[model samples]
Target: MSATPNDPSTPNTPNTPNTPSTPDASYLVDGLRFAFGTLTVVPVRVTRWDREAARGGMLWAPLVGVAVGAAAALCGVVLLALGAGAPLAAVCSVAVPAALTRGLHLDGLADTADGLGSGKPAEDALQIMKRSDIGPFGVVTLVFVLLGQVAALAQAYGDSWARGALAAVVAATAGRLALTSAAPAPVPAAPAPRAPS
Candidate 1:
C-alpha cells in the first residue's frame, strides 16, 4: 500500500569514493625533488623533508645514480672520442662522481678509516670519526682506494669505453643500493603538515 518510490539511476559514480580518479602529480614531483635534493649537489626546491618524503627519496636514489653515471659515462666517452688515453679518461670518469657528490662518500670513507684506526672503545671510536681533520689511516685509505678505482677503471676502459661506462653505471647503482639498504627504518617520523599559506 506504500506509494512507489521515485526511481533514479546514475552511471557516473566512482567505484572508490575517497580516491581521486586521476593520479596525483604532486607525489611524483615531491619524490624527484627529494631525490635530487638528498643525493646530488643539484639545486631543487624541496618543500617536504619528512619521513614520507625520505622514504620516497630512498626509492628514487637509484634514479639519481643513473643520472650521475650517465654524466660520468659521457665524460669518459668524450675523452675517448678526443683521443685521450684510457688512464686519463678513467681518472676523469672517477672524478666526475666525486665532484658531483662533493666527495661526501670519500668523507665517510675517511671517517670510517679513522674510527677503525683508533682501536678504541665504540664511544671513543665514534668521537674520533667525528673529527674534521684526517688521520694517518684516513690519508692512507684515501690514497689506496682512489688509486685502486683509477686502475680498475683504466683497465676496463682499455677493453672498451662502453665497458667502462657500463661499469660506472653498475657501480653507481650499487653504491646507492647500499646507501638505501643501510638506512634506518621509520626515518625519524615527519613533522606535522603545515597549514596552507
Candidate 2:
C-alpha cells in the first residue's frame, strides 16, 4: 500500500515541492543576529552558525557598521557638547568603535602587519599571525595607524562637530562596506544521497 501524503512513514524526497528552496524571513533574522553578535560587543544571541547563517550575516554586516558609526559619532558629539576639546572628542570617537568591536579589527590589522613584515613563507607567516603575543611589526603598525586616525579625526573635529561626526560615520561604514564587498560567499553543502529503500 502507498503511504498517504501526510503519513509519518513517508521519506522526505530531495527537491520535493514541500521542501523550502529559498531563504525565509527567519534566515534574514538569523543573519542579522550573526552580524551583530560577531561584529560588536552588543548582546545578541545568534541561533545558527552554519554557512547559510554566515552568508546571511555577511549580507547584514554593513548594518552593524552603521550602528557602530552612529555610536562613535554620538560619543564625539556628546563630548563636544560638554565643552571637550576637539582632540579629546576625536579620541573618544575613535575609541568608541574600538571598544564596541572589542578591538578585533585593530588586532587583525596588527596580526596582518606582523605576518607580512616577517617576510616568511605562507605557512610561516600564518604561524606568526597565530601567535598570541604581538611582534615589533604589530606594535609599530598599531602605533602609527592609531596616531593617524586620531590626527585625522582631530583635524575634522577642529573644523566643526558635524564634520567630525560625519567623518567618523563615513569612515566606519566604509570600512565595513569594504569588508562586506571583499568577503567570499559561503558555498552550500551538497545534499547527502538517500539510502536504498
lDDT of each: 0.79, 0.85
Q: Write the per-residue lDDT of candidate 2 for residues 31-148, one digit (tens) a residue.
A: 8999999999999998888655777788788888889989999999999999999999989999999999999999999998999999998778888998889999999999999899
- Candidate 1's displacement at residue 93, Å, is 0.6
TM-score of 2: 0.83
What TM-score does structure 1 among the candidates reach? 0.79
* Cα lDDT tens digits for candidate 1, 3-27: 2211123232344221124324665
Q: Which one wins on lDDT? A: 2
| Model 2 accuracy (lDDT, Cα) | 0.85
* Model 2 residue 33 distance off true place after TM-score fit, in angstroms: 0.3
lDDT at residue 83 of model 2 (Cα atoms): 95
Give the top-scoring candidate (TM-score). Answer: 2
